[model samples]
Target: MQLQVLNSPFSQEQAELLNRILPTLTDQQKLWLSGYLAASQFSGAQAAAPAASQNAGQAVSKDVTIIYGSQSGNSKGLANKAAKTLEGNGYLVTLSSMSDYKPNNLKKVQNLLIVVSTHGEGDPPDNAMTFHEFLHSKRAPKLEGLQFSVLALGDSSYEFFCQTGKQFDDRLEELGGTRLYPRFDCDVDFDEPAAEWLEGVLSSLKDAQGAGAAEAAAAASTLQTIESEYSRTNPFKAEVLDNINLNGRGSNKETHHLELSLEGSGLTFEPGDSLGVYPENDPALVEQLLNELKWSKEDQVTVKQGDVRTLQEALQSYYEITTLTKPLLEKIAPLSTNEGLKELVAQGNGEKLKEYINGRDILDLVRDFGPWGDSAQEFVSILRKIPVRLYSIASSLAANPDEVHLTIGAVRYEANGRERKGVASTYVAERLEPGDHVSVFVQQNENFKLPKNPETPIIMVGPGTGVAPFRSFIQEREETGAEGKSWLFFGDQHFVTDFLYQTEMQKWLKNGALTKLDVAFSRDTEEKVYVQHRMLEQSKELYKWLEEGAVVYICGDEKHMAHDVHNTFIKIIAKEGGLSREKAEEYLAEMQQQKRYQRDVY
Candidate 1:
């Protein structure tokens, strides 16, 4: 339907302009436009009436504050998106990181939106700690006039899925803040739910502030910027240039050093950024699952509303079949005739449910539950899409243009009398080969980045595959001729076979790109000496470096190594600086606020 001057109230040029843009607008855009036009007509009608009636429309607040607490940049990206949306609708938006936002200003905010991702074990992300503390503290003020909404990002696989967001939502309501829209808690697949939350929030805002507030120019500009060549939804397939095992013959571990060619993909990344890989499930596992279910491999299943693939193909590439979640168990329970499966997921069986889900997969569930009662299509319909695995980039773009590198450790373990393999890690280690293509996208992490001043010294503590980003960091410093003094504390099981990138580290040390190196081989020593022990050994010098303003970067196992390393820093600071443990903690927290201490642990 073309807009013409003969039928429409628009001039010939205006009609042509509308016709050109109407076809390009998305369904969401069209909805916004329609609401805006209706509101404008309503406002015009009121403007021509009595002046006394105009006060109510003019009293609506146009200010919105968006704060994000992000660990891997997802929340930050969404926060920025929400800011743009609000701005496009003629609202004055104030977007900030939770660490940077003033808690005292909470009382003044009319409309507030929080986009935060829960970190390890229900804890708030590093950047959100301060704000989270302040909000929950006794000093927190009442927010009677505040209207808020929260979009929480988390993985349902974790025991405390979106716990931090739930805390914020509850706390805000406790302080008398009204919900502009109910909080939305998202699992690993958050894009759709997040978009829905944003739309709902925008609608509520329009209802409250009047939809005539939209700025067409701003909306058009925002729509233009939304176009991207490649993203999480549309990953770029990059060819693998090299794939080699980093461990020697004597090692118990299998770590692959993978180099991918990003030529013509235009996917560039910095040292601190991560590469997200979409990997396929093992064919052997998929075959086993199909055989167990007594389903035909050629059976067609709908992966989504429009996408369809064979049962085998869907299990192999489209859905996540390895890990089992509580939600998955509940969804599949009704389809099963097994009394045991139903009882395990029954109410008041929370502890048992968590125990069962800990080390078991879909295959384990199917085997243990007994005879099933669902078709292949129905089974696959409830499965979540395979989440992309993110590995810290191991090469600098400046040093190796049109290429990206990753250090992936094969995760092979025995649990519940069955051998288990990591989805992406084992895929890279055992299946991927040179010249084979892998779909990838760059995930920017602003929280874990080098200092802007090249001369600032740095201390990096990375154990095992955690050393990946530090490799990129050192390479970047070397390539850019950075004058920063670098110290690296690396640990592994053995010195002989587990010294990953040993030659590269030696070359960088010789060239003075790395100022100091300390390695701890846990098994080689009489006692298990980890990175923390090494740091404690060099406490004096480490304290001196901290005093000299050296930025600290830690990447590795968050459950143990990162936690130990963090405490070790505090111990060193307390012992050397003659401060109490509490004071030392304050010092470390201050460093975090200054962006001198950053972590990229998982």
Candidate 2:
């Protein structure tokens, strides 16, 4: 008898049973199921069964659901890759951003894969908050029959790497869902590890499929479409059109208006998207390091799988020139036995290490270490990679399809009479001259987009350069002729010197494009008022707007401003709206679940 499995036609009750059973599956059982599912896809005539029996009973090949929770685009890329891989193997794949997925649809999942990245301090990515909360809530249904797996990505330097993935694994188990395989927690350099994990997952799932199911998969494989093009590792080189200091010369802080031409690249992005700028090391810093160490500039070095012409070339072309890590300190610590260095690496002194390394560079470390013999390869290997710097796109594709613009704050600070330049920021602001070409890529932000309903009012709270995307939003709204009322709350140090896009904002207000403008110049007043303070002062009106279904958007410093603004909204709901603390909290949470309260805070 030949049994064919095209896609498991799951009944609502069958899905609920699988969800209930998923968390109870043992490790060996998970491995068994994974292998069975994988083999079933290619089992061909060998594992054939009666067609009616196969449809009614056990079946391995099912529609694969790929859901991703991405803060920046890393998880999305991984999810996209996973979908393509399964599609290649003849599996029907449904891919959706977690924020867009209906939370109740988990009850309909027979085979589910979640790819999520943790944000600051173990928080789920902005888009995953709803799904994360729902899974742990009392309202979540028991899932005893579901088979699932999670691949979590995070930065190991953070205490809570892959935290959301862990949460999903635990919660799914608690709800009685079976794990298809052990969850994989990946760190900063996740590509190799992620690929290995993916291979394991696919190999296991391919083994348990019956012959007829296998033939069906083979048929679907030929119909799959996979993307082949430049990605983060290989970005398109874009020529810089202009790089002007937006901040005045006399002002303490330096910021720039960077315009890069993306003509003929076929790259497209929305307003809230970020541009990832790949930067090269500073030549001056490299020369200074060579001089400080008394190392020959002609010394050859190899790193990660490639060789460089010289030590200077290696430093400039590869390796991080700024931001010293604990590993670097550890390498130098033994040589120095300096009390400070020893104390930094000592037991129960994590905070001390953080304080010591916050702003210091490699030069400072070498100066204190008294110079020693370390190969260029060892030095660069121990050092972190030069990560791409992300800047919010300040221009809309609707306005400029052939170019992208950025408002970048040049990071310059003084310490020990030496100037420190932020590796990537300085590279973009000072080193990359106008007309120079630099590699670039787009990072989409689906959570931060304007509401689908154009008439939905938007209240934007972005101080300093956080106001960058709001400009794009206003432009987009103007171009689309949206009837939504736009209100902006922007703050900086001074009105005279710190107000960005002053003329444009004034024009927007004058032309009725912007319904309200609230400016908070923290330094102008002795009392020091910020955007949150302004929000609090206008609690009555703010509450009214919230009541009238205005979508609240906050983007800026996450440490203080975002938190403060969030708390202010909660207070306004409590005090101005006459709700209790818990009720006000519920109201805010409801708004987030409803997607009315959104943030793009960095």
Top-lDDT structure, candidate number: 1
What TM-score quantifies how close candidate 2 is to the native fold? 0.82
Per-model RMSD to reference: 8.5, 8.5
lDDT of 2 at 36: 63
lDDT of 2: 0.79
- Per-residue lDDT of 261-298 in model 2, one digit per residue for the tens? 98987888887788888888788888888888666788
Alpha-carbon local distance difference test for all models: 0.89, 0.79
- Model 1: per-residue Cα lDDT over 1-602, one tens digit each: 87779977899999889889899999999999898777656654543443334566455566899999999988988888788776656667999999899999998999999999999999999999999999999999999999999999999888889999999999999999999999999988887788778877887776664443243333434533563677776799999999999999979999999999999987888889999899999989888888888778999988878898999999999999889899888888888888899999999999999998988888898789853646888878788989989899999999999999999999999999988999999999989999899999998899999999999999999999999999999999999999989999999999999999999999999999999999999999787999999999999999999999999999999999999999999999999999999999999999999999999999
Where in model 1 is the C-alpha error above 4 Å? 1-58, 212-227, 371-373
What TM-score against the true fold does each predicted structure earn?
0.89, 0.82
Model 2 is weakest, by summed lDDT over 10 consecutive residues, at 219-228
Cα displacement (angstroms), candidate 2, residue 481, comes to 2.0
